[model samples]
Target: MMASRILMQRVCCVLVRDLRGSSSYSSSLTASATVQPFLSRTVLRSSCRSVSFNVQDHDDFTERVINSQLPVLIDFHAQWCGPCKILGPRLEKAIAKQKGRIAMAKVDIDEHTDLAIEYGVSAVPTVIAMRGGDVIDQFVGIKDEDQLDSFVEQLIGQ
Candidate 1:
């Protein structure tokens, strides 16, 4: 019984550390001791339904984007691309604003050369909006948040 209680306290400390990031250890300890179960449920629900995820391969791409029930926004990017780093998160924020009306698929261009070539991606941060397995719209380069939001809205017919 003592060992189990210690383990539970340790788990709570980790949870508070992860959730708050740089939280005071004393406060985290207090919160964890008082509100561990509630915090755990909230964290689980949010993390499980993340809007964006990386495409593992061509088959994964086909399964997720080409056959998705919701319209998909594919971000063709590379790790070394500066613009891609800037745009990827912005695009994700825009997609999240839609509240499950759309989904975002991240594709690493360097890893998926064939997909980049097939899609005619000549630059990093190439965004492709697709529906019904067809390319509905595409643009190459980083777009500002408003432009990204408008692009997404247009695809979902908003």
Candidate 2:
């Protein structure tokens, strides 16, 4: 679950100009590159339940997530659910905010009920984290981008 330090620097100019009354996008502010952080395996092992964010299909889940090099985050959701709707935009914003470092995927429980059932997703908007495809972290509710970032950083401490 090791990751580089993440910052709130991935916001777009339109977002900044809209939120901060400033159109001037700074290189230090809008940067979205993923830097590989140095982490001792022991340190990473100490923080096992770190959070991750990414998106991939159920079939591709194993190959891209479980087996891929980057950690994975899965958002289990259903379109009819309210919290899922709210979390959806937040995660999209996160995707924009942490462009290259994190990956995010949304699972429609209704469409992929089997995956949901296998993962024991009893609720909508449940987020799960995996390192090398093994279930390593999980949360049962909606998390804003900052909270999500902190959760993941705790594992890899990016």
Q: Give the top-scoring candidate (lDDT).
A: 1
Q: Once all C-alphas are superposed, what RMSD does model 1 give against the true structure?
A: 9.7
What is the alpha-carbon lDDT for the whole of candidate 2? 0.61
Q: Residues 42-142, candidate 2, lDDT per residue (tens digit)? A: 23222222233333356656655667666667789887889888887876666455544556656778877888898999988898777676787889888
Clashing pairs in 1: none
In angstroms, give how far residue 92 of model 1 lies from its true place: 0.9
Point to the candidate with the largest TM-score: 1
- Backbone clashes for every candidate come to 0, 10
TM of each candidate vs. truth = 0.72, 0.58
Worst 10 residues of 1 by lDDT: 41-50
Residue 12, candidate 1: Cα error in Å is: 20
CA-lDDT, candidates in order: 0.82, 0.61
Measured by TM-score, how close is model 1 to the native structure? 0.72
Could you tell me which residue pairs clash in candidate 2? 4-158, 5-158, 53-103, 54-103, 54-104, 54-105, 55-104, 55-105, 66-133, 153-157
